[model samples]
Target chain A: MEPKVKSAMQMKIQVRKKKTIVAKDRLFSFLFILPSILAIAIFVYGFIGWTGYVSLSNWNSQIPDFSFAGLKNYVSLFHDFRFQADLRNTAVFMILFIVLVLGMGLMIAVFLDQKIKFENLFRNIFFFPMALSFIVTGVVWQWILNPSTGVNLLMKKVGIEPMWYTSVKVIPGVEWGKIQVGIPIAVIAVVIAAVWQMTGFSVAMYLAGLRAIPDEVREAARMDGATEFQIFRKIIFPLLLPITISVIIIMAHISLKIFDLIYAMTGPGANFVTDVPGVYMFETTFRGNYYASGAAIAIIMLLSVAIFIVPYLLSNRKGES
Target chain B: MKKKWFAFLSFMLALSLLLVGCNSDRASKSGGNGTRLDIFSWWTGAGEEDGLKALIKLFKEKHPEVKVENAAVAGGAGTNAKAVLASRMQGNDPPATFQVHGGAELNDGWVAAGKMKPLNELYKEEGWNDKFPKELIDLVSKDGNIYSVPVNIHRGNVLWYNKRIFKDNGLKAPKTFAEFFKVADQLKAKGITPLALGDKEPWTATQLFEDVLLGTLGPDDYKKLWTKEVSFDDPKVKEAVKTFKKMLGYINKDHSSRNWQDASQLVGKGEAAMNIMGDWAKGYFVNDLKLKVNKDFGWVTTPGTQHSFMVITDTFGLPKGIKNEDDVMKFLSLLGSVEGQDTFNPLKGSIPARIDADPSKYDAYGRLTMKEFKKARITPSLAHGSAAPEGVVTKVNNAVNIFVTQQNEAQFIDALKTAASELK
Candidate 1:
């Protein structure tokens, strides 16, 4: 009985030792991440909160006047002609950019998937633009599409020269409130530049998706007496839906927050034709010193990007669960 | 247990080290005994860069112990520098002395925001009271406190024309709007482009509009527009708008794709007959394009207002929280001195702000402009952020941009009227 009691006491001490070891491991792990948590909490979330507060205040000028102004900055921004134009431009640019990038990316990826000659070379050529920054792309494309000197010079020889970005002509010419509610012709130039720079990313994604698909699926579709186009439409294209969604989400965020490309290329092109909320936010905030109004614009931009990302994130989380 | 404690302690040390590393950069830079003086400006272009280098070289010669750091940001007309300065000012890490446009930019931007120290004492001590023009002094002052010392004055109401084009066409430089249109028509008939313009940034068009306002409203009434004494709805303003619209009709077809320099290049290449720009275009012409002032290009006041000088002065001032106060004051005094202004302006292709600057040090164009600076009524430029705050200037630029595309006079005028509210 004494030996049995001693054995029980030894077992209890071992269990306590195991518990202390587990607790100590957990405490060390938490301590390891504590600095990152604090930094992110203070730097990112704290600054975002401060910006949100500034957007609601009367700190329009250089001086930080924290007096409450309610939604005055937001209200004015909505009514602002430039802001309205920025909205129209952003919507049109986002749609056109996404559609073009997806179509071209899929086509290029499918072409590369074939046992074509120089497949690696073609893939590299399509993907090379991704390596260049938007600023560099904007600058190079600016020269290429300069109304008089660039592509126009060549097009003029063909007896037809489109004005390119210099044209302030809005399509459909539907006047809605302060801005013309249509796709600005100048924005098309920016879209072309953006698409050229970004299509490679989508191509790489779609190619990865294509490569991940088993050879059996395509062979099975062919065995079912399907044409090559039909096999692609029925099997391969459907398989790329996940990739398509990802590309859309990624491109949407980029287009919504695009500042450098448009800023470098056209700079709110004649009458804010190529103006995006990002560019307006920058000019208003930094150049004009309208901090509150700039903050309001920034919030609007965040909400815009969120409109695409939030649902995507939620759906992703749901899928994971 | 020892390993866990060791890991935790190491993690804490690493984080603290990271914090220290981030702070040490700023600490090391600012730890000196006020030896470094950062002179910030957007003077990285051809002639302007040379001017800044010469100014820095001159300062180093005068004060060998004081190190002058030329923090020149390269962008057209301080577009990049202004934003950098704004951020630094907000962070309370201002450079010793920085460049700013004199009037509404310095006064309304920094001084009104309580970021600048009043330079009344500096001006009085340096006897700059009688050196710069009274109207010029009024621009850099608010509430009777002078805030900056103007170094170089750029005339904003200058019309630059290709001398060869004018000579080939047997045309005289136009002196009025009616004459300008006649010349424009003659140039158009001769298959040459008239009034080269690059409104890619929009401020170029706004500057042209401001020149039109000066021509129509006269300098006094033009100044009153900023003060709210003369409403934008005045018939004279409408006339100015109409004249501006007419002038716009003669611009290059690809004007929207180009910048001010590109437009100036059109004139230099003789592809276009004329360009209305600031005298800095002279710098681009002489320094960049290697064009002679009188032989290659000729300048006249924009159509009208020949007696009114639209001044866009690049001034330097002391920010409130800078460490090198004495060094900054010495730099400001140098910028205000006759010798410093003469040395800088001749290279910069701008007239010295000090009326007493030596004329012999200037080129023919500079000499002519300096003479005009003494006699002409000095008016601040709207596009360059002298006549109004930057917000108002941006609004006006937007309005001008819309008008450029839409050509709707009523809408443009209404936009101007709305923007006028911000003038207060």
Candidate 2:
């Protein structure tokens, strides 16, 4: 009976010790992460707050002190024709760019996954454009896209006479009034540059996903008399759904914040048909009017990125669970 | 183990705090000295750098104890530099002295907020009124108080032509609008671009517009149009726009994306007949491109313009919380002095703000402009001058850019009217 009572006491002591150990572990974990938390709170939060405040004021080149203008800046921004045009341009860019980049990236990845010659070499060649800075790439593309200087000249050499080379106006009765678009040359220049830079990143991600497919699974499909096209359509493509989704989210984020390529190619002025939301914010802030409007634009862009990405991330989390 | 981790975190926090403290202390000490003057300007390139270095040397020689820190942020046309300045000023960390064009845009907010220090006392003490021209003094002053020191006067209405090209083509410089068209036609017939123009920068387009307005509608209409005294849709204004549209045919085919300097190069190489640019282009020709003015190039004011030359001047503004009031006074005094103007302006490729300087000491173009000044032929450019504010200028720039590129006259006129209505 005494031995039995001693064993129960010993078991109780062990349980208490285990609880203390876990408490210590928790303390250590909190201490280790404290610095990062503090940094985010101060720098990130502080900057965001400062940006919000500046946007609400009547700030200009000469005005040092900014007074609160409330919704006046936002009102003016809405009234600004340039801002509206930029918003429209950004929307069009986001939709078209995402669709093209994703479609191209997938096709390249699939082609590369096949037992092709110089597989690694081909991968490097496709990815190499990503390494160059957007500013340099934008400049090169601008030269190439210039009607007087670039493709048109090459076309002329080939005896192809395109009317866009000399004419500034769209030819009437052209499909949807599209023939004489002056600014599209610059816009096309930006998209081509962006695609050239971004496609490599997508290719890399898609390649990783493609490589993760099991060799045995393909052998099993073959044993079942599945054709190459049928197997890929039914199996491998479905498996790459997550990677595709991730690419879409990332590309969407990039397209929304695209400023440098557009700005470098065409400066923030009237000739700028490729003006994105970021460039518009810059112009508004520089001109020192309706900073609140600039802030509103920034917040709108942020919300847009979040609206798309949050759902994607949440679904990803659910899938993991 | 947990105690150790807690101690480690505290140590890290302390270390970070110490590092931050050290940095802040260093920054404060650097800025504490009254002798340290943070000077900001948009001077870049080899020629501008050399000119600025010369000016700095003069400044240091006069005040050996005072330290002048150059905060030069160079970009094309001062765009990037101005944006940086605006951001800094908004953050309430303005430089001690910064460069601003003498105009209403410079005065709009700072002067309204009482953030700029008036240089009136310095002007009186230095006898600036007697040294500088009355018109220049008026340009820099607001409500009888001088807020800036006019450093140099740049003539913005000059029409530059390649002398070799003109001579080869048997074309004399145009003295009237009618003759200008004839010269343009002759140049075009000779397989040459009639005008070395880049319309990508709307301000370059505005240069031609202003010159035409000065030639066609004269000075009064120019002022009325800019100051919102007359609507942009007025028949007289339309006439000016139409004349500009006619002149558009003279521009090169590749003008849409060409930089102003590249346009200047076209004329420099005699690929084009003429360029309507400011006298500052002379600096590029002589200093950088190794072309001689009046020998290889010729400059004239647009014809039939009644001797009116568009003049813009750069000046220095003292920020509100300047550290060394005495040093500031000394600097402002020196900036206004005849000796200072003579030393600074010639290097800048501009004439001294002080009219007392001898014209014989200046370059050929300077001497001619000095002669024009003597004849009272100067009229302020509304675009470059203080007639319109910043917002209006940007709007006008946008409208003009679209007009030049698309050639949509009705839309251009409407945009101008809308922009003009916004000026306060």
Q: Score each candidate by Cα lDDT.
A: 0.90, 0.74
For candidate 2, lDDT tens digit of each residue in B1-424? 6888688878788868966985784367346564477678887766556666777788889899888778889887676877787767766667778877787656664565577888887877777777777766766777888899877888877788999988887889997888999999988887889888875556788777878877877776776675678788888878888888889988887676666787888899888889988888899899878999899999888766747767787788887865666766667677777777777777788887777786776888888787676556555665563656666676777677767766777878898888777665
Q: After superposition, how far is residue B365 of candidate 1 from its true place, in Å?
A: 0.5
For candidate 2 chain A, the 10 contiguous residues with the lowest summed lDDT are A170-179
Give the clashing pairs for model 1.
none
**DockQ-based CAPRI category assigned to the predicted complex of candidate 1:** medium
Writing each residue's lDDT as its tens digit, candidate 1 over B83-184 gives 898888988889888999989998888998899899889888888899889999999999999999999999999999999999989999999988999999
Per-prediction TM-score, please?
Answer: 0.96, 0.89
Model 1 residue B162 CA deviation (Å) reads 1.2
Clash count, candidate 1 = 0
Error of 1 at A131 (Å): 0.3
The residue-level lDDT of candidate 1 at B390 comes to 92
True contacts kept of each: 0.77, 0.27
Model 2 docking tier (incorrect/acceptable/medium/high)? acceptable
